[model samples]
Target: MTQTYSTDWDIEKYRDDTEPEEHWELRKAFMEAHKGNFSEEYLVALARTFTNIEFMGCSYPAAVMRRIAELSKDVAKTYRENKKTKLQRTFVSASNAAENKIKKRQSDPGVLPAARN
Candidate 1:
């Protein structure tokens, strides 16, 4: 039997195997290096790093992840505002649901207190 692999497959496999920590380091370095000149490659790489970290179920600080999520949501909102597509509308709806859940959790009270003697 013969084994063959495409270059694209190899690249993807390599990326999939890359450590999230390394990706995060690279993203940080890129941001610091290109602070004012944000290139498409840097943005894409950062997004990929975040996706990889999310997919691998890596442990990150809740505050950091929440901030990342908030930034992503803001970008999505901007995209939706610019595009005004049905898909974007759906995304907005889903975002509303998520926000509602968060709000409800925050507003919800636990068990009621019993009457004082």
Candidate 2:
């Protein structure tokens, strides 16, 4: 089971994020070191270290990161519950809207085709 897919598109930042580019200490350090005279192996080692920052996600899809982040967190619980509630609200709203449109159309006799005598 070596199959894997990237979830960066599902990420909020990748979707419609207006936020500035994220900064990381490892990236900053990597850039600083790369600016100096360093051997290929040394740069490779640094790259490896930087990549290790996400070592936990090495074998898992990026989507799992949100689940891991939610583990043992109050915000996660709140988000889950709120998400359900919001979904329910959306369903009700859509149903009502459909019903209203049907009613509006039915009430307006001119909108319907005339019956044959």
Candidate 3:
């Protein structure tokens, strides 16, 4: 009689067994992939992955994670400032348009123009 075993296996166990050098390689690849401006979610996911790398005894450096956090703060600050500026411009444009409309009504050729005092 022949006994068969299940093909399914635990991937987490294999991931945990990865060498420290492999973690460093992965970290380098991650950084390269996100070399330019990135979103908060992407930064967060990279940080989280590195945190796990450390937890797994993969020897990924802690300083990289700190840098990522700092970059995240800067990205958020810039985003907020840009949003505020855009909002201010929209409000100013709308106010100017409304004022122009009022002036046109005041000087309407259809209705008699305002009399000089």
Clash pairs for candidate 3: none
Per-candidate local distance difference test? 0.47, 0.41, 0.49
TM-score of predicted model 1? 0.24
What TM-score does prediction 3 earn?
Answer: 0.22
lDDT of 3 by residue, 14-112 (tens): 233445754544444444444444443454357446545433534446786566555445333443466467634234688898888888887876765
Q: Clashing residue pairs, candidate 1? A: none
Candidate achieving the largest TM-score = 1
All candidates: CA RMSD (Å): 15.9, 14.1, 17.2
In model 3, the Cα lDDT at residue 75 comes to: 32
How many steric clashes does model 2 contain? 0
TM-score for each of the candidates? 0.24, 0.22, 0.22
Report the C-alpha lDDT of model 2 over 29-109, residue by residue, as the tens digit: 343434333444444344334433332224345554453343214323443465466634234688898888878777777
Measured with C-alpha atoms, the lDDT of residue 96 in candidate 2 is 92
